[model samples]
Target chain A: MTDISRDDVQHLAQLSSLALSDQEVDNLRIDIGNILGYINQLSELDTTGVEPTYQVTDLENVWREDKIDDYGLGRDDLLALAPESKDGQIKVPKVL
Target chain B: MTKISDYISKNARQNVLEAIKRANDKNEYHALLSFTEARALERADAVDRGEITGRLAGVPFVVKDNFFAFGAPTTAASRMLEHFQAPLQATAVEKLEAEGAICIGKANLDAFAHGGSTENSAFGPTLNAFDKTKVAGGSSGGSAVVTALDIVPFALGSDTGGSIRQPASFNGVVGVKPTYGTVSRYGVVAMASSTDTIGCFATDAADAELIMDIMAGKDNKDMTTLPDFFKPTNVKPGLKIGLIKETTTDDVDPEVKQATLDYVARLKAAGHQVDEVTMPISKYALAIYYIVVPAEVSSNLARYDGIRYGHRAEGVATLAELYGKSRDEGFVAENKRRIMIGSYVLSSGFFDAYYLQAQKVRTLLINEFNKLFEDYDVLLGPTTPTPAFGLGENTADPIKMYLADIMTVPASLAGLPAISVPVGKSSNGLPIGVQLVGQRRSDADLLALAKSMEKA
Candidate 1:
């Protein structure tokens, strides 16, 4: 079994940009640990010299014209989806 | 057992109204999230006035809530997007609309298309269409149930792993997961982009075929989409099919195995050659999927950091707090579990061991499939190891829940086209499904074969 510590879970949460509660961190510690243990079974396979498959489509570097097509959605329409907007731009908490 | 033809002969308004009424009647199942009544009625009136006409011609349908459609908010069954409306319709939805298909409502799903059952839905679990005590297999659970209940002839679903196929199996419907890139993913909520494919659920294979034919095409908006290679073909005679030996082992439920063999027998009656073929690497597919998918999922979900759209947390002083708190509030437990797992695997020290190793193993798994396809036109297996499990039966243990996808994930990891067709029921009376997997670009053939054997 994977010995995923509470701190390990917290570090993962930080990496994932998630502010987990003490209870969540405790629960996820066990849950994520079990998941890792299950997925670790992949190591049993002998994949020596096997090339990794990143994407299934044989197509590569599919280039398209740089023409901007918003599919009929206008700026206001997109801005309308944002949680907060001001002065025709998205508003966010002040970045340090 | 509704069909596209049922609505084709009726006025668009009548079809749309009837579908809406059925959806409301079956509300206890929690298959639907919200109705697009106003937009549907307006579109129905247009079709009645002869302004809209096509093959589907006013046939009503439902989309899994993950899709961006007009009338309702496109929540991916999560609190994050609960009230978030899509700026544009998904290309798949647009294509269906072009064929005069009216979308009456959005169906429920596992939050962010994660988990094997709709039990993970943030709103609530969608009840199985067959027995409310059992779960609706997911994350396409709601779409499958709506079709099974005959609320609509067909519905759209996206399959990243076993989302569409497993649910369709549980609900006794036809589900299609086209070869990777068969349909554009644009306007659909992205989940593990490498494996995500837009597909549909239907009462029968023919409706699934027509829906796939219409939605299968290239879109400049999504570069991963293949140049439309899907052309429906009649099943070739005396086809050689491989019944995967790994899937029918003693560990699988006896009823599920019997149903799969029964389907194979029907193939034999139709003069197709069925052989038990070995693919040992199939055992490791779920492990590889768990690693690679979550890694991709973590990256894909990073876009939901609360600044641009979706949910936001108030009372956060710093930008980091805003990002963290909002995400913590917006996402459900399963979402967090996947994201953290993804983070752990993709982090610097573990990247090579977990993520890269899984990818290499994935290649090995696909190679085994390719080798088998050389002798077999298609591979057959049970869609799930068992029938629909009781609600919350495996929810407490995440690994137990993940095992439900063991049979279907191999085809998904290989980016192959696979379909699940309802065969028979277990002694306990739960529906069982047999899955047919074809090589990439053989989406049309897979459906054709399933369609031909529909009666049997």
Candidate 2:
């Protein structure tokens, strides 16, 4: 099994956009290690000529009309449900 | 005595009002999170007045809270969306309503559909129908309990690995996980997209089929949905049935194994040939499932940042702190565990070693299932290895909980249709269920075969 470390966990948190706490990071280090160890058993399988099954639905390139269809809900109606909104736009905390 | 149609035809408002009252009087099982009494009555009145008419006209049903329905907050038994009212209805809910099925309430589930037992629900655990102390097997625990209690004739549930089938088996009810794309998944909270399916729990296969008939179809919203091919069929005469040898292991609970064997005997007596078959790759199903599922969950749940919706933490000035604290607060321990595991496997250097490898393993599992289907009309096994355990039995250990899904995950990973039909009860009086798995587009045939077994 590939060894997972604190830095590895921190880097994953960044990739996943999760801001984990120090304690959480430490906890994840152990938990992730256990999980990886379990899944690593797959490496023993002889998948020599096996093709990966990605999407289950065999349907392909299901085309639809290129026309824009209105969902009928108005902007103000949708904006009304937003937890934080300003000037008819959804508001988020400022990011650098 | 009220047949399903009779209850459905009676004034929608009064029917739901009485059903809610009956559910409240029991108090033996805490199956519902909240009752949409006012909204249900309003919709029921519309159906009675001819303002609404369809297959489910005025029929009352409950949805596992993971589904986004108006009138009630869609809390997937997580604090994350506890107070978060959905801005819109799930595509599945909207379709059911279009047929006049009034959603009376939202049922409980494991937080983010994580655990095998509903003990992980943020609100509280749902009790099993037969024995109040035992768990309502989850993560669709409340949906199964509500149906078993006869509060509603049916309830909708989302099954990822074994959420619907395991619970239905535990509760002595019919649980169906239609072919993966049979029902739309536009608004149901994503748990593991590759295997996630919306299905239902009902007292009998007929009622389950009625609900499936209404909900099965393609939608512009869910592109993955297959063109509707779900027409109920009669069981073919002299069918070939395969009893999976691996699922009927000595390690499985004796009662569960006996129930399955007895079911096979009955099928044979009815003239369908029952023979033992082995799928060696079946042993590796859970390993592949845990890897691939968490990977997808990590991606799907990333949308729940503290910004747009869901819970936001306080005293966090920095944007990063806000996200960290909010997710840490909103999610339960299992959700965090899964998200972290997902992150670890999908990390830059480990992606091919873990995530990609798991997908390749999944292909082998599917190939084994496909090869078996070519020789057998359908595969039969126990829905769960054992009957429902006590509420806190496997809570502390995550791998133990994952093992409960061993038999059900292969069908899920293959995207085939499967069902759990009540066979008998254990000596302790807990219910036991048998699973019937069929080819990708053979959902109706599987249900028919299950119905024939019911007659036997």
Candidate 3:
């Protein structure tokens, strides 16, 4: 059995910034537990001294000039894509 | 003149026009989301006028809607992006266009590429090319079906896990998932970043290789792209091939198993040595894939909050309501399921137990693949457990849908180059495909081996 619990699911939802419904939470309680139970099978493997591979590309530290390259799009071009905009700034719902 | 090379070189415009006519004729399939008719015709005329020239000069192709293309909206078969017109083309599309390939249409896919079958597509599931009642094994389902139906000679697809290969197998086309970073992911919609790969579908291995050669390269915009290392090898000395024993178990459909064994027989006849090899960690691949992929999906998909872009809820008074309602309305059930699962696994307290454990298992799986590669030049297996199940067959159970990818997920986890090539067919007449997996940088070699098998 996995150690994942309801509170843990709630904490994860918070971390992921998702406000799941009560039904969703209940469903995930069982789904996450089953998923965790499957993933827990990995604990049997011996990964001693094995290095983790984060990225697949062999090249590293590819630096580029920090100069600002013109994307060639003007304010109108940018604002034209916005569903709501005012005076060149994208309009958003008030935060506070 | 009907050959791919001649068709690409001499009759690009005529070829695209003919393909468009055929696609229009078969209106029942709905394989294409939107056709870039005017743009494609104009580009074809340019190729004919000797204005644009390259290796694939004038060859027309379709891109999965997930890739941002100039002519049509990259909807990703989701309602959220249904009206979202891309400001620019994906780097992959741009690269292919640079080589003189014309983008003709955008193909259908599962919303956010979250499902194994295209049934989860917001627009509607793409019917199988061979049988209308069956699903076009998905998120790259439409891409595969279009190629199989000869709507286009080749199409571009993004494979997060088994999206490309499974569909290709289901449709009897060649599907290639190159080593991660072999092709840049700069403009494609992000889906499990670590596993997401841009690939292609073609009717044959040679055409697939040609397209791969054109698309494989380093891009300054995507830091993860490797320098162009995909050179097709001509050497045909016997190769050390491993037929993954786990994938050929009794659980696999009898026809799929037979097709795989038949292909192995052909490899042996071609003077390549075939041996059964075991990677014990492969058994845990699906579990690892679900945990790690959803964790990434949850993060990657968080950007669609209905604020900055794509769909907004109407009559929303509060910010939180807008986000929740818009997303709940826009995203399909599968997308929500994955996102919630992702949220559950990556939660703080359970991170060590779920996410971290999965990562460790991923490491083990990769190590096992590396060990196998030390002994074998390429790994062989069936691409899917079965081919093209009827639509709605696995819809009731999500795990059943996920299980279809069990044989293909190990390669995705390891970020290895893998391909699905048509070997034979089932007695019931469905196409069966066999998968070939190689070490990270051995994409070209793997394709070359596949091509050699074709000759044999």
Candidate 4:
């Protein structure tokens, strides 16, 4: 079984953009280990030449008319859903 | 069963009012999060006054909270979207409303439809309709319970893995997880992009078929939707049925196995042929599902970064802290576990070993199902390994909780339509369901087979 360390858990939390607490990281360390061990059973399958099945709609490069489609959603309505909005734009933390 | 016609025949106002009362009375079960009483009553009055006219006029239903509808926020039982009012309603809800079906309330679910049990819900777990001690199997537990409790004749739910089917089994209702693209996913909380399907739970097979028919069709908003193909038909005799060898193993609860076997016997008695078929890759389907689904989940859920809608962190100066803290606060433990696992599998070094390999095995699983479909019109099995378990039984172990979906994920991976039909009760009086899996686009025929059994 693959044992996930606290550091490993932290790394994953960082990757997922989740600021997990020490207790949460501790809990996830064990749970992630068990889940990884469970899914590790897939290593036995020999899928050498098999192609990956991504989307299953059975359609290829479905295209629509090259035009703007608002889907009946107005800009002001969507912008209003944000936590903070400026003049026609969403406000965010300053990035250096 | 309170059929749709029953609601239409009765005074629309009284029908909806009584249903809302019954649902409110069953508050201990926690089947519904909030009632859309004002909207529902308004629509009921309109229907009574002949303002609205359609197939499902005056019928009341419930939507799992993941779907966007008016009157209540689409919480998905998560703190993130707990107060996020939907700007638009799900296409499925719109369709039902177009047919005059009134959505009376929003049902509870596992946070973002993450766990098999609604224990992962931020608010609280929905109790089983039969026994309060046992879990109402989820992530669509509330929909199943509402239907089982007769609060509504039918309720809408979204099934990614076995969310609808497993919960239906636990609560003893007919639940359909239609072909992946049969219903549009627009305005529905995204889980796993590839497998998320819109379906419903109903008291009977004919009602299930009616609900599915209304919900199935293409929508331009969701590009993944398939063309309209669902049509109800009489069950044709002499259909070839495959009894899956994997689901009836000794490890499965004896009662569940027996329920499946009893359903098989009924199938034979109804002049259908049954044969044991082996799809060896089904043994590995759970493993492949965990990898592929989480990868999709991680990608899909990335949208909840405290930027647009939903929850945001308080007093965080830096952008990084804001994103991180808001997400950590918003998501339940299961959501983080899945996202982290997805990050690991889809990470640079492990991509080929985990994500790509799982996808490859997925293709193989689909191939095995295709080969088996050549011989059988439908495949039969136990919907779950066991009956509804105690509320806290599997919550401690994520792996144990995942085992609840082992028998149902193969169909999801292959994008096939499957349904859970309540067969009988276990020794303890808990419901036992037998699953019917059909080939792609064979959803109508599958419902017909279950309906034929009901008539018999």
Best by DockQ: 1
lDDT of 4: 0.92
Off by over 4 Å in 3: A1-34, A43-51, A70-75, A94-96, B1-3, B9-11
Question: How many angstroms is the interface RMSD of candidate 1?
Answer: 1.0
A22-85, model 1: which lDDT tens digit per residue? Answer: 9998999899888888988887777789999999998999997888777897899989989999
User: Who wins the lDDT comparison?
Assistant: 1
DockQ for the candidates, in order:
0.86, 0.57, 0.43, 0.76
| Predictions in order: lDDT | 0.93, 0.87, 0.85, 0.92
lDDT digits (tens) for residues B1-456 of candidate 1:
878888895889999998998888889999999999999999999999999989888899999999999999999999999999888999999999998989999999999999889998999999999899999999999999999999999999999999999999999999999999999999999999899999999999898999999999999889999988999888888999999999999999998998899889999999999999999888899899999999999999999999889999988989899999999999999999999899999999999999999999989999999999989999999999999999989989999999999999999899999999999999878999999999999989899899899865
Residues B344-368, candidate 3: write the lDDT tens digits: 7777776876677778778888878
Kindly list the per-residue Cα lDDT of model 2 for residues B1-456, writing each as its tens digit. 123576756788888888888789866677888778888988888888999998888888899999988888888999988887777788889988999988989999999999788988988899999998899999999999988988888899999999999999999999999999999998899999889999999888877888888889999988899998999878998999999999998989999999999999899999999999998998989999998898898998998887777887877777877787788888887888888788877877778877888889989888888888888999999999999998788876677888999999999999999999999999999999999999998989988887777777
Show where candidate 4 strays beyond 4 Å.
A93-96
**In candidate 1, residue B63 scores what lDDT?**
97
- Model 1 alpha-carbon drift over 4 Å, by segment: none
- Superposed Cα RMSD, model 2: 1.9
Provide the lDDT at B240 for model 3: 96
TM-scores of chain A across the candidates, in order, are 0.90, 0.82, 0.79, 0.90
How many angstroms is residue B432 displaced in model 4 relative to the true structure, after the best TM-score fit?
0.3
| Decoy 4 TM-score against native | 0.99
| Candidate numbers sorted by TM-score from highest down | 1, 4, 2, 3
Fnat, one value per model = 0.91, 0.55, 0.36, 0.75
- Looking at model 4, residue A64 earns an lDDT score of 75
- Let me know the TM-score candidate 3 reaches against the reference structure: 0.94
